[model samples]
Structure formats: C-alpha cells, structure tokens
Target: MKKLFFILLILNFAGCTSNEEVADRSQVNWQSIEKDLQSALILAEEGDTINIPGGYFKFEKSLLMDDKQNVVIAGAGMDETILSFKNQNEGAEGLKISQCKNITLVDFTVEDAAGDNIKVSDTDGITFRRLRAQWTGEVSETNGAYALYPVLCKNVLIEECIAIGSSDAGIYVGQSDSVIIRNNEAYRNVAGIESENSNFVEVYGNKAINNTGGILIFDLPGLTQYGEHIKVYDNLIQENNHRNFAPAGNIVGVVPPGTGLMILATRNVEVFNNQIIDNRTVGAAIVSYELVAAISEEEAVEADETQAGSAERINSDYELDENYNPHVGNIYFHDNNFQNSKWFATFQHDFGKLFNFKSPFNPPDIVFDGFMEAERSPAEILCIQEKQKLVFINLDAPNDLEDLNENIAPFVCD
Candidate 1:
C-alpha cells in the first residue's frame, strides 16, 4: 500500500510540473507568425472573432487594438498558445488594448513584456479568462510591473487566470470599478494580487502563494479614486515570504516579506474565511499610511525612543490631496484561519524591522497600527472575530507606540 501511494504521489507531482513548465520553442516561423498576428489585429473589426491556433510565437513590437467593440481574441489554450515578448523593442506591453468596449481575451499565455505583460486601459466590459501572463526567468526588479493589468476600466471580470514573476503586482486592478477577480492563481511576484484606489471590487476563490505579499488593498495618494467597498474572502494565501524585488521609488517596495494580507490606508474593506498560513511575518496587518511613510526616515524612526511621535513630524514632508484620507477605518476581519509556521518576523524591510522591534518572538497573527479618526471609536473603525485563539496587537501608532497592548475590548463589536 505504501509503495502504491508513493507511486501515485510522484505521478501527480509530475503531471502538475508538466502543466506549469513552459513549452519549448526552439524552431518556429517567428517573423511570419508576427506579421500574420499583427495583420489580424489591425484588420479586426467590431464583433470580430480573431482565433489564434496553438503554437509559440515571438514578436518584437506590441500587438495593439483600439476603438473596437465586442471583439473576441481567442487562443487554443493557455498553455498551448504562447506570445513571447522577451525580445520586444517597440512598446511597453505585449498586448495593449485601449478605448475598446466589451472586449474579451481568452485562453492565451503572454510573457516577458517591457512593461506590463497585458494592459487594457480606458475600456468598458473587459474580460480575461483562462489566460496566463508571466516572465519566464528568475524574478527580478527588471521584470514587468504587472502581469494582467486593467486600469481605468469598468465592468471587469478576470477569472481562472494565472499571473507570475511580476516585479510589482501580478494581477493588478487600479482605479477601476465593478471588478471581479476570482479563481485565479498568483505566485512568485512582489504582490500576488492587488487593488489600488479601486471601488466595488471582489477578490475571492484565489490562490496567492510564494510572493512577497499575498494580497493587498491600498489607497495611495494622488489617484482619482480611493479604495472603498472592497471584499476579499475564501482565498488560500500561504507562504508568501519571497524577497521584495520591486524597483526603487515604487510604493510597494515598502511592503515587507512574509506578509499574507495587508490593508493599507483603505476604508470599507472586509476580509473573511481565508486560510492565511505559514507567512514568516504577521498574518494580517492593518496599518495607516503615516507609519509606512515614516519608515524611510532614519531620523524619524529613531529620534523618538518610543517610535510613537514620529508620524507627527513625518506628516510635514508630504503635501497630500485635500480629499485623500490617510486614516484606515471601517475595516472588518472575521472567521479567518491565521497560522504561522515561523515564529520570527522578517528584517528585509524597515516595516518588518519595526514589527520585529515590537515583537521579537512569535509574530502576531493580526497587527493593527492603532490609528483612528478623531471622532470615531475603535469599534467603528476595526472589528475582528476568530474561530481560534487570536494573537492580536495594537501598535497605538497615533500615540507614537506609547500604549501598545493586546487589548481587544475596544474593537469588539456585535
């Protein structure tokens, strides 16, 4: 029985490996394929269905489409049809769609673009299904920023897609509305999946693993929209301890390794029923923007012994938008299974160092910065309910870490 079980396991492993391995494209008609594909894209019209057969094709310039509606770009299969941009010279994205409506891109793999692998902008009713966007080498800061990117788009649906090896976020939706990202897998990227300054977003039934941070919901400054009405649930976020490889000055460079889920300066977000497992850092971190902004200033982090008063001084450095809310509130976490195999936190980034400074052993499963609006109470800002014994901490960041405690009474709400 043991021998039979071991044989079955090896067979299953091999099958999985073959499915994920990149296809060999040693000899192919590269130039001819590129010309044909580009011609098809150019001549495509509204309600046209452009079908690409299964093969590996290399292109030097971007395949672009503009001002077309109800177009369907279909391929044989995600693993069978590959478009390589490793030698691309002309454009940033491998596939760029702009000013289109009701467009659908399905069942293809796009790899190694100069910028985002596939970027669709200023479009409505975009759908990405059974697609794979990746970089086929060692993960580095030079890799494209986002694998499957849709920005300033509406009525977006991204399902059953795979994104890998992005320097920034693998599956990124920014400044978009009415988005649904479900049943996808994101791995080996800085952030597996992220929603930035987007509204009415739903992320669930996804697997985010082997990335720096599994999932992130953020509202950064200077964007047309602020992140609100976000829901992330029923996901497998595990072992996301990959070292950060984001380029300098990128906002996500501040994200420490070993983070499972991070909610930063966002409001009206709900996270529930996730299996957050084995991340070396905190399982879930709810933080205000001030603490993140202060990490870069050596003087600010060290000048105050307690590290509580630095945010006051750091606030002077930035001129933020008048409508931008730096405070994180109206957040709820419930019925999450947070587990950690490693007890110590990461020292890769300054934010991780701050966490280690606070808890050198047995990193807290949930950490809140303890920043709140002046008129609101803790119960109104944050709420948490766990099925297991929860390890929680409040950094009391607004008070310069003066009243750091594990007290959960103030946040307990019916």
Candidate 2:
C-alpha cells in the first residue's frame, strides 16, 4: 500500500512539471522572432500585409515602421497573438508607426509595455480594429500612459477594441481630426475614451466603465489645436469610480474618482442619447480651465511646501497661451439618462470635496461651473433639454458660488 501511494505521488508531480514545460514552450524564442519580424517590416513594399502567427512573443525593443503606405499588420487573433514588453529595456512603445499613410493594425494583444502599447503619429489614415492593449499586473502609476495612442492623424477609426489598466488614458486621441471611436470597452484607467485637442470627433457605441473618469473631452492650454464639433452619444458611461493612479503632474491626476463624462473648457460639443448611471461623484460636468488650473496651483504649492525645491509653484507672472480660450461655449446636452447613488460622495480630490461641501445630501446629476466668455450670449453658450427629471446646478463659480443657482429655467433650450 505504501509503494502504491508513492507511485501515485510521483505521477502527479510529473504531470505538474510537464504542464509547466508546455507553458514555457508556448513562448517562442524572442531573438529569432525579433530578427525576422524587423527584417520583414523593413523590406516590405507598399500595399504589403505582414502576418504574425499565433504565439506569445516577448520583445526588448520597440517594433518600428516609418513612411510606409497602405500597409497592414495583422495577427491571428487578439488573444492568440500576445506581445509582452514586461522585460523591455529600450524604446517608449511596443509598436511605433510614424509618417505612414493608410495603415491598419488589427487582431493583436499588446500588454505590459513600458510606455504606450501602440503609438501612431503623422499618418493620414489609421485604423485600430479588434485589438487589445493592457497592463498585466496591478493598476498603478507605472502603467503606460496610453493604450491606443494616435496623434496628428487624419481619418482615424478605432473600433472593436479593448483597453485596460493604463495609468493615463485607455484610448487617447490627441491633436487629431475627423476621428471616430466606436464599439470599444475601456476600463481600469484614469480616463477612459478621451479626446484631447481634437476636432470633429464622434464617440459612440462604446463602454466606458470602472475608470477614474469616463469620456473626457478636454481642450487644455498650450496645445497646437482645440477640441471642437465633438459628439458623444449612445455610450455606457457608468461606475467610473476607479481610484486615480496617474503619475504626478499629469493633467488627469486632478480628475476626481467617480466622475462620468467630464468636459473641460471645450466648445461646440453635443451630448445625447446615452446611459450615464451609478457614478458616485457626478454624472456630467462642464467646467473651465480655471478650475483645474486653480487645483493644480494649490497642489503645486502644497508640494513645494512639503518637499522644498522638488516642485515649482505657479507665480503671478505665469500666463496661458494668448490664443487659448479658457471658457467653454456652444455646448448642449440632451436625451441622456443620468443616475447617481445617494449614499456615495466623492472625497478623493479637491473637486469632490467641494461637491460634498455644497451638495452634501445628494450630488447633482449635471453641473456647470458658470464660466462663460463675456462676449458670448447665454443662449449660444449653453443648452440642456430637461429630460429624465435631471438635477442641474449652475455653480456660479465666477462669483464663488455665493449665488448658487439650481434653476434650469434659464438653461433649457428653446
């Protein structure tokens, strides 16, 4: 009986070891794969398709492509082809494509990148379809800044993608024009599905959930372009209450947890036909750059006081760009559903503290900071179609909310 037991234990241990060996064999040799893949990309002609087979590959350096036209880099499937950069020693991205035209990247998973998972710049036409980008381990400040990053590109289409665990943004389209982001799921990041300083963007049919903030349309100062003519509709912006894990000094670090669909100092935006629910802090917020700037200044001063010369405090002479407009106008929200939990209040950031101070019992569904350009009329500046018994507030922040107005009478669109 003792001999039989010993034989059974030996068989079990061997089975476990064999499984481990099989898992190790699933990952191909990185040196050979890198040499062949890089050679193929460098020697590929126009209208070429580079196919990556089904395997887990590790890379130490970025895969780069430049000045190619009508090229397609496809993989077996998003889950079948995994590119991991956990041990990367060089470069800022897993895959970098620059100065290309009509490039398409589809059906691959890029994870644990040191910087961004995939970055494409200066391309006329770019498409990211059915791709997955994520960080494998804990969500923290060390995660990549963006999962799918496209900048200075025209005719961009990002659809059917999954982005997760980015420290900054899950899907960030910056300084681009004519963009469409649809049917994607973004979660566990600082900001999910963000468009910054981009024009003519349409964000629809996407799920933005479990991030610090969901669906941020922001136009910051000192950027080359301003966001305008934006449309956000038919999206599930819900439960984006994930703790902010962005690195220090990033603009998104100021975003309070539990925020959903925050629009900061952008104009010509239309929000309609969406389900915004269960966000704890606030449902939809329209605020100016001054709000963020003030919070950033306060944090900077606090840091300087604590660390002494580690950070610089903003002085009186500091100035924003002359062409940059700090006020938001021509904004409209309609036909959207907003809901928040009554028991929860955001206390993670300064903005949430202010919300708790003013509306302690229940946070408002929609909030406007009441910072508008003096030259623009009220009608042209803002509009909201009152549906779903929306709870609205005009913060009257210009007058320090002394005249805090909860009346939607003046804001209802005619």
Candidate 3:
C-alpha cells in the first residue's frame, strides 16, 4: 500500500510540472508583434500584453482602449514611451480607457493633449503606474481639462505619477470608490487633485505645489451629486499660486480665484497630518446650499434637481448656493503645520460670505501676539523697538493658535 501511494504522488508532481511548462510556452512576446498604433489596438484581445517600445508616437486622433479586458499596455519607462497629441478637438482625450476591466497602463508619458491627457471612465480593476502627463502653453492660453482623470471606476490605483502644467486640475477623480493615489507630484496646474462625488478614497504621500489650488475635494455643480467619506493625509500641499489660464470647459476653469480645497456638499471627510504651507491664498474653502447637504426636507425632488439639472441650472444653483449655509458639515483639520500663508489657514464653511474678490472678509477672533507668544515655551529674545507691539507667539507650542491668529488677523479684515 505504501509503494502505491508513492507512485501516485510522483504522477501528480509530474502532471503539475507539465502544466507549468505549457503555460510558459503560451506567453506572447509583445515586442515581436506590430508596433503601429492601429495594429497595437487590434492585438489587444483578451489576456494579451502590448509592449510599447522607446519612441514617440504622434497621434492625429485620440487613442482609445474601450471595453477591453485583462490588457496590459506597458512601456520601457516614463521617459521612453511618449504619446503626443497636438489636435485641439473638443472632448478629445489623449488616451481614454472606458468601460474596461483589468487594464493596466504603466511607464509612459503623455503630452500636449487637447483635452484630458489620460482619462479613464466607467472602468474597474485599473492601475496607472509611473505615468507622466503635461500640457505646456502660455499661462493665458486655454488648454483642455485635467491631466489624469479617472471617473466612476473601482479598484483603481494611481501611483508614482507626475502631472504638470495642466490647464485644469493635475489629477482629477470623480464618482469612484476603492481608490488609492500616492507618491505623486503635481504642479503648475489649476488644482492639484480634485475629487468630487467619490467615496472610500485615500490620498497620501503627494507633493502639490504652485497650482491655483492644491488638493481640493469639491462637490459642486455639474459633476456627480455629492461626495462622501474621503481621507487626505500626510501630503505636502504648498505654494498653489498658478492662476486659472485654461479656457472655460468644465467646472474647474470656471471656479473663481483663490479657492483652495473647495468642499461643497461633501460629508465624512477627514484631512490631517498635511503640511499646508505658503498657499498665499485661501486654504480649504467650503461652500454649499441646503439642497446640496440635503438639509431641507425632501419634497418630491427629482434626481436631476438634486444634482444641477441643466447648464443653466448648474450656474443658477451654484449662484444661489453661494449663500447656502447648510452645505458644510463636520470638517476636521488636525495636527497640520501651516507657514507663511497669505490667507486663512482654514476658511470655514461660511467663508464665501466673508471674502470675495471685491469685498473684505474678517478673520477669525483667535489672536496670537507673535511667534514667541504662540509657542508653548516662549523663546528668549532680545527685545528691540522695531519688534515692539509686534506680539510674537512661540512656534514650539503643540498648538500655536495665538501666533496663528495674530499673523492671520490683518488679512481677515473686511
């Protein structure tokens, strides 16, 4: 009986080895396949890999991967594979992946798109790794929309990416779940990362610098209805100073100046452990109406009405909700280091009523005498006449409200 059992185990091991050998032989060498853009698209059948060589591919029209499954489109590196689109067609994205599953785009760069550089819409199991997208033109020239946009997708990951010189947001995601965006850098854009009508998202370990607004979570008009349950932590969000130069297309180019982290009609959002510094304008602006927050008693409201129904409705609802008080809720900012900012560290939900381009807005009442006084342990200093009456708070304090308030009081005045 023991000899028979040994013989059966040997047969099972030999069968497993034979199956592994067959699987290895079945793999495809994508390099030997056609390198033409049209041929690559044709070869992208189920469970196939397309390896793009190191070169530039100028596309007259947009390249699309629509409704495909289990396709891996990879390049040698971000600097090697370049996709350049010079046409300024309306709604033309450089590389669009729509309604697909198990799609992976890795190690490539896209530049000069008329619309979004890379857009993924209504897809699942997508991953964009080591990708770089940029739009370069005069700051006054109106380019397209976001650089990297993923909307209404699930199980998505955007990691080790760089988006620069976008007319709109560098990276924008909307109405998506189970997403992770990390180790990315965004600069010279409208907003760094704008997410609306999304849930279960994590944004961390990113650097957003020198954009109009950095790291925004807005749930305003003309997108999905409402945003909920988002987390943004440990990001270096700073120096978002680029103004809106993109021509008006979507919600981003239309937003007025100096609105950072615009949170409209969003809920259960947590922002913590971020170094928000030198924003020079408003940081974390929230605006919403009672309708947006669903505070008003529900009365036969259509889904279209709840979300801005038409273009006119989008404009009018946004205008009417300018004074809406019920839209802001339970926003928490804790353990953040703010420095040399030109405006308020946190402009509350009602900030729009206070500050506008033509009007003056009063700062919050909390005052810090100076940096020395702001710290928990006041630093010993040589007092001078120039520094007199300039109340200094201690920077060493765990929470230096006094210093922060004193520094911010002058600008908050209406």
Off by over 4 Å in 1: 1-32, 297-318
Per-model TM-score, in order, reads 0.89, 0.88, 0.67
Candidate 2 vs candidate 3, TM-score winner: 2
- Tens digits of per-residue lDDT, candidate 3, 17-109, equal 210011121232212112365456655778777766665555666777788888887876676665667543544788888999989889877
- Tens digits of per-residue lDDT for model 2 on 167-271? 889899999999999999998989998998899999999999899999999887776687899999999999999999876666787778988989988999999
Q: What would the TM-score be for candidate 2 when compared with the true structure? A: 0.88
Give the alpha carbon lDDT tens digit for every residue of 1-414 in model 1: 111100011100111134334444544444326777777777777767888776667789998988888888887778767788989999889999999999999998899998889999999999999999999868988888899999999999999999999988999999999999999999899999999889999999999999999999988777677779999999999999999987654667777899999998899999999999998888998988777776545643443344221001233244457787887899998888988878678988665676677777777788898988889989789987666877778988778888988887788777
Q: Give the TM-score of candidate 1.
A: 0.89
Error at 326, model 2, angstroms: 0.9
lDDT of 2 at 346: 78
lDDT of 3: 0.58
Better of 1 and 2 by TM-score: 1
Backbone clashes for every candidate come to 2, 0, 23
Top TM-score model: 1
